[model samples]
Target chain A: MSRPIYDRVALIGLGLIASSMAHAMKKWGLAGSVAGHARTAETRAAALEIGFCDEVFETAAEAVKGADLVVLAVPVGAMRAVAEEIGPHLKPGATVTDVGSVKQAVVAAVAPHVPEGVHFVPGHPLAGTEHSGPHSGFATLFQNRWCLLVPANADPEAVARLRALWEGMGSYVDEMDAAHHDLVLAVTSHTPHLIAYTMVGVADHLSRVTESEVIKYSAAGFRDFTRIAASDPTMWRDVFLTNKEATLDILGRFTEELFVLQRAIRMGDGQHLHDYFTRTRAIRRGIIEAGQDTAAPDFGRTKSAGD
Target chain B: MSRPIYDRVALIGLGLIASSMAHAMKKWGLAGSVAGHARTAETRAAALEIGFCDEVFETAAEAVKGADLVVLAVPVGAMRAVAEEIGPHLKPGATVTDVGSVKQAVVAAVAPHVPEGVHFVPGHPLAGTEHSGPHSGFATLFQNRWCLLVPANADPEAVARLRALWEGMGSYVDEMDAAHHDLVLAVTSHTPHLIAYTMVGVADHLSRVTESEVIKYSAAGFRDFTRIAASDPTMWRDVFLTNKEATLDILGRFTEELFVLQRAIRMGDGQHLHDYFTRTRAIRRGIIEAGQDTAAPDFGRTKSAGD
Candidate 1:
């Protein structure tokens, strides 16, 4: 077994990411003790039953009482409240971190609640799925995934220590400014989610009021957006609310580009459409080469089966 | 073994769909003989090597000679030329069908070329993946998929025989007016492709002139769009050109909805965003119930792993 990074680690939210963290810690023996808590007593019991944590607490305050490292794993909107609730109970000199999608708001909200002696290093593991809950995590979720670390100060030693913890759990850690991280994610993730949500909404309205044929004939392509649109409502709502400005900025850019294409379609400009579609194929090749995702055919089909 | 639907079937284009149809026919004994042709000698050779046709021909004219059923399986833009090439060679009273995404244009293009004694049916199978070419097809490709048929006052007996052929290959066939089929697919398939193309184009452009960093951090969600953007360029180019009006209408509606969300995001209207996202989730649930797609957790884990 590898050496443990921390004597005791506390997870303030036992959702998908936090549970995955617990599983990874256990798989790698990276933490001497892993304790966690959820917002409700039922989830705490569920987390305990799933063996996601060595110990489960009903409240965030109780969970962090003796943890050497505390991770805030709740939604961005709840980060400040959870941090404030647990701050007084945290062991002195503990490293406080997070797995929220938006790092800027998380740092601004959670940093203020950190005690003087605590190391408040804000981090966002760039791994997740549409599902949420204490039981929805896996040890390999963060395997080969990127984790952005946004430490308020340029303390190399402190950042390195935290990076080691993530590395031990099978993630590659990169350091960047919190604001830039949010903006990067706005273009890559938030804007895409918003677009997916809107398209699904259009299909739903089309299916219900316009015609029932939409769902009957959905396998053609409308089904993919539906899968993305089915993501947890509360979590996404918090995301848009917290990452408003960055999302808006990206959305504006997307709208401008979409308008140009829309006009081309309106004017029967097949060449414009063909040129745009052809251009996009190159980026997909780039993404495959970069290894951000699988290049295989989608829907979990093997290359042979997909063919 | 199941009975053959036609004594001899001729496929005018030996691409992915035609190859898949051949495999399906062979697996189900739906055709006594499958003859196929491609414009290029290489594709015909590839079709023979892949065992996609019982007899490979050098031209559409040669392929359709004496066949009971002739299927035009080329790109929509090539339908008219293919029909004209095979018109004189087709057997008297034979059933002719073309598998194209857009029905109205296909009917208008191919109808005039069909002889008086022939029955012409336009069809679109609601099934496919990112793969193309004669070698990328399988026997099960049409299983449990929808096949839309638009028969313009063609022989009812011929339509029944064709429906039986598709049904024997494990497809569910639905008949609709040619114009209606074009409009429905425009909203469901054509518009979605255009939107996905535009989104991928935006990301591709951003990745090119700006930075490769747009890809390195793609786990944020851009990876999904990349997959959609990787589809066959020529096929998608034809779809936009053939289904212009319906695609434009849906694109217009999509723009209006997108503008509202964009404005809401710009104004920081959290309630509006939240409500929209929530409504979209229900549609995803409906799609899951319809069994058109998997309801598996977007993440690779279940609720037992965590939220």
Candidate 2:
């Protein structure tokens, strides 16, 4: 472990990102010590048992006391309340960052509460899983992943230090305005997620197509949608509620395009369908060439393709 | 190798499914010899280079002349023409099956062209990749994947033989009526694919969300949709056109459900969104438990999840 960058780190949430951050920080010695707080006693106990936290506090206020870096890793909906509770306790000149998916909401919720001389940087790590909870964490979760930091008007030293911490933990950092981050995330994440959840929900509700049939035949294409739809509900619910405008704007665009293709299907317009489908293929090639996803067919359709 | 199940197998249209079938049949000795015919000379040359076909024919009629089993592996739109071209040339008592994603359309298109004594069984293999063409086939593409056979009054023994051949190629076989097969596939594959194509298209159209950002942040959710969207455009276009009624039916359902979700999001109905999102998760759990997909998180987020 290298010398500590932050004398003390306080993480105020015990979910996937927070738990991961704690472990990553400990592994790299980025913080002298890590303290954490969660709403429930069980999560607090589990965080300590998982050995990611050096101390577990009963409240967010207690957790942030004297900490050099305070990370609000709670859901977006919970950020404002947590910020209010911890604002008075934050150390002067301390850097506060968040791991929320949407940036604008978190910034709006947390920035007003930041004390003078404190740095409030809203950040999002585009890495996670369907699973959640304190137990679902690993140090390598952010390795090679993109971590967007929106440190709106924060001191350069604080932003640089935060970037260093993420880089030290294995992430490539990019800075963007919170609004742009929300728009990009809406297209790349929120809208796609809503579509997946809708498809899976439709499958569940269709009486003619039995659940067993949907599950059994999932490997065809529905399985990928299901994999995405299975992500943590609370986390996603907050994401949609917080990023409402951009997500709705994207949904509108998607609906317009979907109607055109839906009309093509209704009218047997093969050329329109072919043209749209072919155009989309170029983007997939870009993603693969950018090394964002596996080029393996069926995403490495190995022995585990089925049981 | 096992004794040849078919004395000679003719594959019409050497794409991923057809080419894979040829190589798999030869590898497992399920056919004494494999002959293939595609619409283009380039594909025929590629098939010969790939060595999946024992002989490449210039015409479907020439390929099926002496074959005991003829596989109509072209797009759903082309099945009827291929069947008509080879109808009189098909050997007496031969078995004809197809590898189309939709079945009712294929059965309607090809069954009428079958000679009285030649058996025709419609089939849909629930296995493939985004890549197509002769060069894209792999012998193990069908291994451990499901191949749903839509048997419509075909001879019992002929259906059994087709099932055995598919089993020999390492696919689990199931039989269903053609219309039901079409409906099930519309829900499981066609509609999801259409939605994915639309979502990717929407992302591409959004000027505010730059293409670079979409590709850069795709791992969050959009990457999975892109993978599905990358599938062969012509094949999918034909599928949507051929399975129009059933796909249109699913699209209606998806649109209805999506509206309810869109309304909930607009109203900030977190409870409704959470309930819907949570319910979808159960289906994902069922899919995993049923062995149709892996329980891996973020679809087993590879090393490039962030990069």
Candidate 3:
């Protein structure tokens, strides 16, 4: 195990991201001690029972009191309130970072409350699963994944230290401006999630196709959408609300493209549909080659006995 | 090994489905002998080299001449030509079936060409990977998957024999009418694929987000869309073209639901967004509880060392 990066690392929310961070830090010995706080007493109790944190506090302020590294792991919508509660309690020279999906809104929400000597480096780790909460986290959740940092005018020493911590947790860290990070995530995460939620909702609302039929035959393409659609509802709801402009921007472009394909289907334009599909196929190849995803077919999914 | 379900089985269009079927049949001894045909000589040679079939014919007519069962595994658009070519050469008591995605269109295309004493059962196995071609097939590809048969006006004995063959190859067989099958697939498969392709296209065309950035950041939900979008372009093209009406219907419903959620985001209606997202989560739980998918996180996908 490596030397600890910080004497005390405090996580402000004990959900999947926070729990996973605690586990990864413990696995790598990257922190001297981990402290956690959850809004719900049940979650705090579970985190203690799970034994990922050395200490559990009922208040965010108590959690941040002696920590040199403070991580805001709450939903985007809850970031501001937690920041306000923990601002005065953060150690003078501590480094603060977040695990929010959108960078710009997070920066806007939490940056103002950071103390004069403290550093705030907004970040988003490009990793997750449909499952959520403390039980859903694993030590390898961030393994081989990208963690983008928006270190807008933060001190160089603080930025480097935060980067080292993420690297220790098995992430490849990159620095990007907050606006660009938000826009990129809008295209890559927020918008795709919105589309998936919409498609699954459409299936749910269709009266002619019973729910059982949809679930039974979901292996045919729809199941992939359902996986993403099943992601943490509150987190995703905050994502759309916080990154409104960029999400809407990508959504508009998506609808424009969908309409074109829809018209092609209606007009029986086989050539147009074939060309479009062939172009998209190349993108998947690029992703696999980039080592962002496995090259295995069907994401290397295995069937349960009754599937 | 199980008893042979057919004396000789003919598979036209030796792509993923046909190749997998051949492998499954061979694994279970479901067919005494397998005869295969493909439009290209390279594929026929590959089938022979792969040794899944007893013989590979240059034409469908030659392949089905003495076969007791024939499977049309070509793209939906090519079903008519394949049926027309092999119609006269089919044995008097043969049962002709297909693995096309859309049933109503296949029935319309192949029914007229079927001889009087022969049975035409249109079947679709709800199984596949993003990969295609003869090299992609595996013997266990159909294990625990669903195969729907639209046995319109076919003799009961013929349908039963076909069901037995699919069961031998490790599938649970169900029968549905042609129209309902087409509509159900439209909701569960075709339209979802179209949406995924369109969303990936939107990402590809975005000038602000470089393709490299999109690929690098794909693990944050976009990679799932890319998997389905990367499916065989020729097959999906034919699926949309043939299942036009039902796909269009579902696309309309999808857009309407998307617009509602889009409006909520624009209006900053968090409750609406949260409710919609919460409702869709139930559908995913149903899918997992039905044993259609694994409860493991991320479809139980194991990342490669570099991923």
- Output the number of the TM-score-best candidate: 3
User: lDDT per residue, candidate 3, A198-231, as tens digits?
Assistant: 9899999889999999998998999999999999
- List fnat, each candidate: 0.67, 0.82, 0.86
Which 10 successive residues of model 2 chain B have the least lDDT summed?
B298-307
Across B1-307, the per-residue lDDT of candidate 3 in tens digits comes to 7679898999999999999999999988899999999989899999999998899988899999899999999999999999999999999989999999999899999999999999998999999999999888988788878999999779999999999999888888999999999999999999999999998999999999999999999999999999999999999999999999999999999998899999999999999999999999999999998777888888887743565
State the C-alpha lDDT per candidate.
0.80, 0.90, 0.92
Better of 1 and 3 by TM-score: 3
How well is each residue in B1-307 modelled by candidate 1, as lDDT tens digits? 8678899999988877899999999988999999998989999999888887888888889999989999998989889899888888889989999889988888889998999898887788888776678887877777767899998688899999999999887778999998788878877777777777776666555542244766777776666666676777777878877788877777777878888887876677878878888788777666656656655555232232211
lDDT of 1 by residue, A4-70 (tens): 9898999988888999999989988999999998879888988889887889887889889889899
Model 2: what TM-score for its first chain? 0.97
Candidate 3 has what TM-score? 0.99
Docking level of model 2: medium
The residue ranges of model 1 lying beyond 4 angstroms of the native Cα positions read A152-154, A207-212, A302-307, B207-211, B299-307
Candidate 3 regions exceeding 4 Å error are A303-307, B303-307
Top candidate (DockQ): 3
User: What order do you get sorting by lDDT, best first?
Assistant: 3, 2, 1
**How many backbone overlaps does candidate 2 show?**
1
